[model samples]
Target: MQRDFCDPLGYMGTRGGDVTATMAIVPRIQQVRDCAAAAGLTIIHTREGHRPDLSDLPENKRLKTARAGAEIGSRGPLGRLLLEPRPGEIVIDKPGTGAFYGTDLHHVLATSGIQNLVLVGVTTGVCVTSTAREASDRGLNVLVISDCCAEPDPLEHEMAIRLLQIEGGYIATIASTVDFVASVNTLAQS
Candidate 1:
C-alpha cells in the first residue's frame, strides 16, 4: 500500500503513464466483487472516464485535463484501466466525479432495494468522498472501507476521512480488508 501507486505522486495533475487512470483499487475491487457475490450483494461500478468521441464529457472538464483525450473509450493509457463488469454486475458511466451526479444510479439502487452502499474505489478526496457524500444526501447508508481507496495527497485522504466521520450523512464505517473479509465469511457461515 506504500508503493508509488498509493503515493501522491501519481493521481493529481501528473500525466502520461500506464497507471495514470488505472483503478487504484484493482486488487481490492476484485476482492470486494467476489465477496459481494458470496454475500448476495449486488456489485456495481461507477466509471469516471468519458467516451473517445468526447461526446460524454463537458467542455470545461476536458479543458482542465493534462490530456483532453483520456476518457474511458479512448486509446490512451487511462482509458485502459476500466475492467469490464461481470454478466449481472451493473456499470454506470458517470460524467462527473460523483457517481450519483447526473446519473440514475440512485434510482437503480432503490430499485434493487439496496439500503447500504459499501463503497470502494480511487481518489479518496475526490471521487470516493463525493460519492459517499452524495449517497448520504440521497438517504443511502454509506460504509467506506479505508483500505479500498487511495488519494494523491495523504493530507487530503485524512481530511476526507475526517469530513466523512464528522459531516457525512451517516457515521462512516472504516474497516480493514482482513476484517471485512472475515465478517463476510462469518455472515456466509451464519
Candidate 2:
C-alpha cells in the first residue's frame, strides 16, 4: 500500500502537467492498508524512484533523462515516504512505469506466495494502470481498487478506468476502499 496512493500532489508536491488532484483516494488507501495489515497479508510497496548510482538499471538513456526529471534518486517530494515500510513489508524501488519494471517485484511476489495483487496507487493513467496490465499479463490476479487510485485530472482517471476494465485484459472493478477491505477479509477467510 502506498501512502501517496494516487495523489501526486502529496507525493510529488506538484502535479507536473496534470491539472487536478484526487485527494479523496488517500483515505481509502489507508483503510485498505490497515485491513490488509490486520489480516497478516504481506504488504509490498512500489515507489517511483531510482538509485543515485543508477545501479537499478543499465539501459535506456531516455529512462535516465526521465528519472533525472522525476528526481528519482534525490529525496525530492516523491522520495519522502509518508508511510514508512514496516518489518516484513517489501519496499521495491521501481525505476519505470510498471512496478515490476526494472525491479525484483515478480521474484518477491513469487517468493511470498502472492497469487493475487491488490494494487492501489497513484497516477491512474500511468503507473497504476501499467502495473495492473503487467500483473495480468504475468498471470497474477490483479484487482485495481478503482476508488483507491487517482490521477491529477479526473478525466484521465476516468479514461484509465475505462481502458483497464474494457481492454486491459484484467479483472477490474470500481470498489471503494471499504469494500476492498471487506473483500480482502472475505478472501482471507476463504
Candidate 3:
C-alpha cells in the first residue's frame, strides 16, 4: 500500500480519512504476494498516478485530489505521487482507477498467457473492485483476497465484496489470505 493511501501522515490520513483498516492489510497482502512468487505466478502491481505535468489526469479526478490537498503528480512521502516499484517488479502506472483502462495490461496478460488474476489493493469499493470487474469483463478469472483488501469504511468494504459474490459468483471469486496461500502451495506441489 502506498503512503498516500495508508500512511497516517500521508494524503488520505492527513485529510481526515481513516486509513487504519487499509494499513492493517499490508501484512496479509505481503503473505499473498510471497505465496504467488513462490508458486511462479505472474505478479503485476498497479499504482494510481498521473504524469509529472498532470497532463493525463482527468479534470474531475484532478479537482478531487486538489481538494484532498494531494494533487496527483506532486511530491509525496513516497518520493512521488505513487510509490515506486522495486527493480524487476512489473508495475503498471494507471491514470485511472481500473488498471486496464489506459494501460497495456491486456497485452501483458495476453502475452503472458494469464487467464486468471489475483487482485489485492486498497479501496475495495473503488480501485480493487474496478480492477476485478475489468478483469472479469476481459474474460479473466478473478480472485479477490478478502483479508488482503481494505477501504476506509468497513461496512462499504464488506458490501463491495458481497456485491461481487452475488449472482452465483458472476464477477469474482473471493478468498481469504490463508485460503489463497494454501491453494497456491497445493498448486505448487502438484
Candidate 4:
C-alpha cells in the first residue's frame, strides 16, 4: 500500500507557540523524512492558518488564539512552517485540527492512492489525535509516530498516545520513531 506521513500542527519556535517539547521531535521528523524517501512514500505537512479574517472561527476561539500569539496571517514566526518542506512535497494549510477538515487532503490522498498514514507533530492530544480519529473514520489505516509527537505536558502526551492506540474500535497503532524507521528500512529491503 502507498503510505504517507502526515505532520499536523508542527509550528516551530516560541514565537509561534509553546515549542519546547515540539523541538525535541525535529530530529525524529528528519528521520521520518529519510525513511519516507527510502520507502518511496509521501510526506504531507499541515500548518494551521492564522489569517486576519477570523470570521471562520468563533469569537472565543479567535480571541484565545490571538491571545496565544498565533494569528495565522500575522507576520509572526508562528505562521511559518517550523521545518522546511522539500520541493514537491505536499504542504497543506488547514483551518482546523483535523487535517481533513476544510482541506483538500482527502482528495489528495485518494488521488495519490494512499491507503496508510503515519501521523506525527505537535500537540499530540489535539491535532495529532484529532487527525488520527478523522483518518480512521475515513477508513485509512493509521499509525501514529509516538516519539515524533509532543505536547506541552508530558502526561497529556502519554495519555493522548494511549487513547489514540485504541480509538474508533482500535483504529490506530502507535510506534516510536526508531522502530518506525527500522520497519521502513526493512520494508525497503524486502
Error of 1 at 68 (Å): 7.4
- Model 4, runs deviating above 4 Å: 1-18, 50-55, 69-72, 77-79, 167-169
Runs with alpha carbons beyond 4 Å of true place in candidate 1: 1-25, 51-56, 66-75, 167-171
Clashes, model 2 = 4
Off by over 4 Å in 2: 1-20, 55-79, 167-174, 187-190
TM-score of each: 0.78, 0.79, 0.93, 0.83
Lowest-scoring 10 consecutive residues by lDDT in candidate 3? Answer: 78-87
Best by TM-score: 3
Question: What is the lDDT for 138 in model 4?
Answer: 95
Question: Which scores higher on TM-score, 1 or 3?
Answer: 3
Poorest stretch of ten by lDDT in candidate 4: 1-10
Give candidate 3 regions above 4 Å deviation: 78-86
Candidate 3 lDDT at 86 equals 52
lDDT on C-alpha atoms for all candidate structures: 0.69, 0.72, 0.85, 0.74
Q: Candidate 3, residues 1-190: lDDT per residue as tens digits?
A: 6777888888878888799999899878888877887787778888886677877889898888888787776667654333345556698888988899989999999998989988887989899999989999999999999888998889999999999899987999999999998888888888
Score candidate 2 by TM-score against the native: 0.79
The alpha-carbon lDDT assigned to residue 170 of candidate 3 equals 93
Q: Which residue pairs show collisions in model 4?
A: 16-78, 50-72, 50-73, 51-73
Q: lDDT of candidate 4 vs native? A: 0.74
